[model samples]
Target chain A: MPPAALSVHLSIGQAYAWSVFKPPLESALGLSGTQSALPFQLGIVMLGLSAAFGGTLVERNGPRWAMTVALICFSSGFLLSSLGAATEQYWLIVLGYGFVGGIGLGIGYISPVSTLIKWFPDRPGMATGIAIMGFGGGALIASPWSAQMLESFGSDSSGIALAFLVHGLSYAVFMLLGVLLVRVPRSEKPVESAPSAFEGPQVSARNAVRTPQFWCLWVVLCMNVTAGIGILEKAAPMITDFFKGTSTPVSVSAAAGFVALLSAANMAGRIGWSSTSDLIGRKNIYRLYLGVGAVMYGLIALFGDSSKPLFILCALVILSFYGGGFATVPAYLKDLFGTYQVGAIHGRLLTAWSTAGVLGPLIVNWIADRQEEAGKSGSALYGLSFVIMIGLLVVGFVANELVRPVDVRHHIPAPREAADVGARQQPESA
Target chain B: MSEHDSSQSPPDRRPLIALAWVWVGAPLAYGLYELVQKATQLFTG
Candidate 1:
């Protein structure tokens, strides 16, 4: 089959590429693992912010404009990071990559989601997954490419600087492909004979915020993200640390490959697992994500350092589900609420991501740092963290269970003129 | 065509091209610098 939408694919690549920079950045800047991760963490934070604020703008002005802005910001961020590295200014790296580039990530990330959904209204889950799969898969390509670049460049401060520059430029050109190719579907009025799903009464954005389902989903996404990101942000070090007591300590190259492997799993989860949600329904898929995710954490906590394969397998599964959670949520929203303001709701819902972005890494890093200070080795330290993940997942599972069908009152009907749209499918049929 | 019409000239592509450079060229330049330096390091190392 032909490749998926270009914009969706590119955005995913851009987001996933951040991980490639993490290790070398840490080594070159003489930063700790947590410190090295801060840019990504903060970039995630800004992703929610920009997406939320710019969502309406995206809905009004269209994905093309939002994507254009994203290309500019994201590319500039790379250039800025390069400058920072060349000048030995860590703050600039954070500012450029985390803050500025993060905005690009947020905007670019959401740009394709709503647009893709509109194009494939019949298959919202699969469509969203197809787009989001890129975000997940982007890392797989980026990790190897980045590693190769670092290997070639010497892994020094200057080497990192060069990598940042190249990353900035290349991604900018690549992302521009999305900007150039993105086209809004023409607003064709439906014939009178056709029944319209979007033609019904509308729900205002203000009222949609008041519903319990919204808050329930908010909690669900927040907890799910926190669970997954805790593992992702610290994948390389966490894996090595978990295996520290093993007879065969993980080699640096091996650990990096492990990171790449986890990335592949993450990417694959976005497509394979999330696409499965379309068949099983969003709620059931989430049950698997949270319940299985919690179990995965438990397996880790209980089995610490005994079997490397088991540990890696569990972590990979958890990460995959984490990616699936992200990929599937947009479709979930479409299923619950109509697409009238899904983009807006999606933007609002991303606040959960921003919160998790901070909470996930903080919880993992803080616990790990404390454990290391206490001379806790291997599985012992992670036991408490995994327990916490379990609790979080349980909470998420409860939130998912709490999701009843969205109230009819919350539906944001199309504008009065467009109310009789015969082109769109009726919710009754859905 | 009138003298004024001839003098008016075609629309400037400079600003548009300049914008693309800032957006496009800047990132490429940075990436190239990094790639080149890294290539050199690999050779020397």
Candidate 2:
């Protein structure tokens, strides 16, 4: 199950590395920074929309069907994007990578989650953690690989198109492994007989969204993701700006290294912190992610320019929290609502990620661009953004605090009712 | 199948499990290597 999850996640996680293509696309296609970001931004938007709309279908048809659909859309998005680059049509790129590929990401992201939770009932956190960690690690592989490809092939439109074609073909083949290997648990019965951490009444995906607990979690996820992405989206440039005039000024290569380090932190946090949540309880672990995260942002804002080590350490911790937030949320959902329809609930929850994907980069980049226009240098460029992130994390902390067990009225009446409803509601194959 | 019977059911299953682990681990391992290579640039360059 973990392997199946990893195959899909590692392929789709390439979205995080889209920034590596930004400069080349901007130069070759004559686009502004905002224009270059449009594909990635729209892809995230589509990811949320597709996941939300497709969530119930995914739940109905099961993981194999969902994963197969993801494989086709994601691979085809790359092929279409290649044509877009070759033709120099920006809209094609957006349609291919953003709209089509985003659907792949959305479905692919949720595909294995519920199955893993069911298979590993005793440790939902660890189960989900292993798979989601691959999503964070995807960029670690793709960044250098894409960079090397562009270097070898030249950074022209034709070269970029070729790279896209290769990516599409390779990822399609890779994701197929997931489709073949994945299996729903043979027996629907809970593996563990003892009372586990996620003891709760089950909730259907349709009813789960109507509850206040779900909405509170939506806010919590949005704020946490927004805070983390603020740093992640700007990691390369922000570090250089922070130490522009220092004795050990950050070079472009070093800035790239910093991005790699952040990726490592992000991947590690997903596995480490989410696994920790199993022991500490989900709510308490989130308090650490939000409350401690706010403190980390404060440290960066206050003293980051004075010391590079302090800056890097603080950034790593913040990125870890960011990864932890993604990895832990599925288990948290299970804790509140039970395993029934968790994939759909998780798909619905990812809308918060889409929201943050847009809002985070906008807040950070807009502020930094304005600061640059105002002749700000060093830490001053990101100071306001960090303060805003701190404020956002504080709000998330409050939302996490307010989270409680879902009301019993929202739960499906019995296990058999859930099974019957699921069987009845099964949708046509994608 | 009983636990003992399942344990002895198929010798082929061991190879399949190993192959599956390799399929999953290879990409992750390669990713880690690339990250390490990138990180080394921070010190060497």
Proportion of true inter-chain contacts also present in candidate 1: 0.00
**How well does candidate 2 score on lDDT at residue A82?**
97
| Tens-place lDDT digits, model 1, residues A1-430 | 0022444354435555666777777878888987887888788788889888887676665666777788888888878888999998999989998899988887778777766665555566777776776665555456557788888986888998998888887777677656654543322422112332243333444565788888899999999999998888787677778778889566665666666566667767887877788788899999999999998998888885787778888988988898888889988877766555667678888999888977898898899889989998766666778889899999999999999876776664444434223112111110
Clashes per model (N, Cα, C within 3 A): 13, 0
| Global local distance difference test of model 1 | 0.71
Poorest stretch of ten by lDDT in candidate 2 chain A: A421-430
**TM-score: model 2, chain A:** 0.92
Give residue B22's lDDT in candidate 2 (0 to 100): 88
Which candidate gets the maximum DockQ versus the true structure? 2
User: Model 1 Cα displacement at A128 (Å)?
Assistant: 1.3
**Candidate 1 chain A, run of 10 with poorest lDDT:** A421-430
**What C-alpha RMSD separates each model from the true structure?**
9.5, 3.5
